[model samples]
Target: MPVDLVPTPGAGPRVTFTGLGGAELIIGLTGQSRQMSRWALGFILIAAAGTALARRGCGSKVIFIVVVLTVASLLALWLPATTDVANGAFMAGAALVPLYILIALVQRLWNSLFVRNM
Candidate 1:
C-alpha cells in the first residue's frame, strides 16, 4: 500500500492509504503516534543527508555501504511496526536511499553530457 501525506485546510498533515481500502489515517495526535512521526521525520532527514553527500562526489562504495546499513536498520524497525499498518513508512524509508543515488547519477550524467567544457 502506498501512503500519501496530504495537507488539509486548517489541519495538520494527513496520511492517506491507497489500495488498502482508501482510508485516511491521522497520526501524531497522541503519544505513540507522535513518536512514530518523529522517527519518520528523522529517517527522511538522514536519507536526504546521505543523498547530498553522495551528490557531492562521495564515492559509490561508501554510499552503497551506508545505504545497505540504512536499509537494514529500517528493516529491523519495520518488522516490529509491520503489524501496525506502517508499510508506507517502511517503503519510503527504504526507497529514499536508492532514489537519491539515482538522482545523483542523473545529475552527473547531465553535467558530463552537456556541461563539459570540451
Candidate 2:
C-alpha cells in the first residue's frame, strides 16, 4: 500500500476517541477478538430469531419475545461469563421495539399529514 493510501496508526483512534461510544468500542476491540466474535455471533443469532418470529405470523408476539430477550440479556449481566454475549444480545433485543414504534409513528404521521386524498 502506498504510504498516502494507508492511514497512520493513530489517525483512526484519534477520531474514534472523540465520541464516548466510539471510544469504548475501539478500546473494547483491542486484543479481544474472541470476545468480539462471540458478541457478533450472539447478536446475529438473536436478530435472526427475532426476524424469524416476525415472519411467521407472530406479529403481536414479536414484541413480547423481544421484551423477554431483552430482560434475559440484562439478567445475563449478573454473570461475568455471559457478559460479552449478553451485551450483543441486549443491543439486538433492546433496539427492535423502539425502532418499530418509531417507524410506525413516522408512517402514521406521514399518512395523516402529507399523504394525498384517498
TM-score for all predictions? Answer: 0.38, 0.47
Which regions in candidate 1 have their CA more than 4 angstroms from the true location?
Answer: 1-32, 58-93
RMSD (CA, Å), each prediction: 12.5, 11.9
State the lDDT at 64 in candidate 2. Answer: 55
Q: For residue 107, what is the lDDT in candidate 1?
A: 87
lDDT of candidate 2 over 1-118, digit per residue (tens): 2223356775645432455454322123334898898788767877787665553443664765667586666667677667777778777777666755666678779989998986
Candidate 1 per-residue lDDT over residues 45-94, each given as its tens digit? 55555555554544663665466456656665876543233433344546
